[model samples]
Target: VSCIARHISLTVGCCWLDGENQPHMKAVFPTEKAVHDHFENLLRILSYEPLYAQIRIKRSNDETVLVGSSLIYFLFIVQMRNMDWLSDLNTTLKNTMVSIIDASINDEVAMCCYGVLCEILTDEESKDLSISDNICNYFLQMLEDIWNKTKKKYEHVPIMMLLKGFQTLSKNDSMQQETAVSNRIHIFIEICDEYPIAYDVIWALSFNKDIQQQLRSDSPFICKLTQLSRQPENEQMSKIIDGILWNLEINHENRSMTDKHNTKEFDIMISYSHKEKVLCKQIYEELIKAGYRVWIDFDQMHGNVMDAMAQAIEQSNTVIMCMSEQYRKSNYCRAEAQYAFQRERKIVPILLQKQYKPDGWLLFIIGQLLYVDFNKYEFSRAMQMLHNELKVELMAETHTAPVRPKEDSVVAHSTTYISPPEVLRSSIVSENILDWTQSQVQDWLLGHNLRQLSRLFAACDGRSLLYLSKYMKNCEPQQILDLLEADSVRRLNESISLIELSSFHSVMHEKKKRLPSMYSSNT
Candidate 1:
């Protein structure tokens, strides 16, 4: 602790103006003894009332500011040792850190102290082990706010130090396991935007067995990063930025996504049929009035049935599938079911009829996962499940998971619906599969007009058709079906972007001698 105290000013090269034209570095601390005294006294006070200690340090004057360093080290020790102080310190430290950040400080000594303070305060280790929902939530938000405020000025030690702090904070199993890992990653990516240099800290930590092992669970972050990593270096960097933004938006959205329809702020998509529309719309309005970014077919799909539905589904954080008799009777509902199943989006099936049981493929999915039974109209309990799901998704996206499929992978559940054994026989189709180009797929999506998707969906029916049309409005669904039905080579190529084609193809080719011939005629 004392060594850190003396090394601070010297390493930072503190300086200030005087009467001379030439600038000069400021004087180092008076003595080693003074530095030790400075550190010891502060820690003694912090270990007393963690919260109050932070308040004193944050509100102190220049003469008393040394308490900041003490508070910083105190938090570090608490985190490294996995002490009980963390739960209490997390709350008080967050409040103190915010206040200190907002306070004006012109002195180099004070700034140096601030840098060390942030470095210790934001340690990801602090987030580990003991889970407290309120503390994790507050800490996650603070890290995000600090990252946004400091990213542009990352050259400063204080800012760089904060990054380290966050890295340590993320390592704490208590905090890391709490679901803020994704948020931490998001903030790191946001700061690293266009400048990969900033990723050094996280990249290093990512190699840690403890960190990587913890992040290996199933999560959307894993899927998103895998997808982002395969893009061209330039685009990969940009997508890193996008990944960060996506997590932030998702985390923020989760708060309301889980709330009851009457209380939720966002308008979530309700994937149901005309019969379930009343109940579905009720949930939708509930989410909307509560302050969410809800997407329904009525607002945007009018132009193209398929495109609208696809757009709404893709844009939504949650998809409520009302499982009523009418819902199953409609092919449209089945199509919507297929779409949600493929995307691996959050799908909550509310079984309205007592006799109806989700079986085969749907049962395999919904059964393995928990869902709300609406046969008896347990509105309150159903809404609670939605809230819990929303929270789980947010946490999952924040921490990078290993099993979630990357974007380049075949649409997750596509294989369930599109069987390749039936489409491998045509020679022209087989050859096309071998020749099918990813560049062609990119060109197709980029070239097609998004506005025309609905007209093409007119041939299909239901919510699923609507969902597809929304995203692929420019491309004809028949062409997509045709492409999908072709040899595996063609389908594989279409699934990934041209920029990522070579690498992915190489991986696939290494695993198998000849690429499977599946869907080609559609291309």
Candidate 2:
């Protein structure tokens, strides 16, 4: 049994790939094929005659049941569209699960069974025409049965999945006052602190004004959320707390939507599927630390989602596109990506999964943008490249942009104005800052009394130089000199001086007075 369990895990858990053919740290999402291949074991297990079973797995070990059920969960929630036999599979699994639950009360396998069904019913992708309203009601009936069976028990497992399922139902106005929902909500509030799954509770009750007020007034629960928020290591839970605060209007130190991040104009908006939350959160944090105002959904899909998303994207100067198979397939992500494209938001695509190419609509949406593959580059190197790209002020490009591309094939949005390193090395650059030559750039800077910025401008162009101008429009000459000297030294990775602003230019005599380089010893 253990050997079979191990084999099942190994079959489904082939996440990382090797060098060309060797080994590396790249984590690739398991393909639908691999999942279906492993799913055969589940069929074998379910098609059981305890004595005649060729696999010789023991009935006593519930671990096998758990593993098989987990795989089923993934199939239903993550890869349902790929399963042609899903309807039949669902029936077989439902019957088998009923047998398991009848065999024992409050069993872990039974709990998982409920959780899987609830997850599937609530999944955004679970809207196939084959999965009808009757099928949904059948699951709901099972949930009611389980709740009744375990009401006296009142365990987390019973409440855990049932509440999530209820949360989904609560979204419908017709279902709001349903008896089952009311029964669940009553228990959900009374025993809320007993379960750690606050995410489900907060969102399920988001539209309910009375419940929102009720949860807000629950001082102990709010305090518990505070403690969860403070533990930096519990990042997933921390995000959950943030969401809870947002949903219930719980205002604490650093725990409200009224914070600057909500109101401020965003520098970058990240459009991603929830599967990539961890990496996206890391990117968000890094950007925040670097002084860029970033916007991310944070899985907080509260009140008028489309309106909120449009506002965020509108405020952002650029959108970071996290590309993965899930991202490509998700309708929600597709909507966000399409909107960003339509809004003419500058997009930077990053590959969040290995070997997952965008085909249909995603291909159309991103076109030919060069995406940074995490598989090829380490995180640090990738972040450095991202930071460098974002440093050029994105907002400045609005004025410089010409007509939108009529041709749909891989239109180079930002590339038209931003020159390559080799091109920047030459005197002339291109149309916007992206297109202008170095000499033209420096000449403009010299006129602005940002002469010291010429040194920093060696590798800089586009919105970056213009951002510096807008940033320092009100700054004193000494202040500009101080900031520029610091930036140049850090960027060039050498100690430069205050006097260096007026001191040197390799292109000073080479180019005409259009922009004169400051006098330096090298001059």
lDDT tens string, model 2, 124-144? 323332333333354345555
> Could you tell me how far off, in angstroms, the CA of residue 260 lies in candidate 2 after the best superposition?
13
Candidate 1 runs further than 4 Å off? 1-38, 41-64, 69-139, 150-157, 180-184, 194-523
The segments of candidate 2 whose C-alpha lies over 4 angstroms from its true place after superposition are: 1-38, 44-125, 132-187, 204-241, 248-316, 321-351, 354-523
TM-score of each: 0.25, 0.37
List clash counts for every candidate, in order: 57, 17
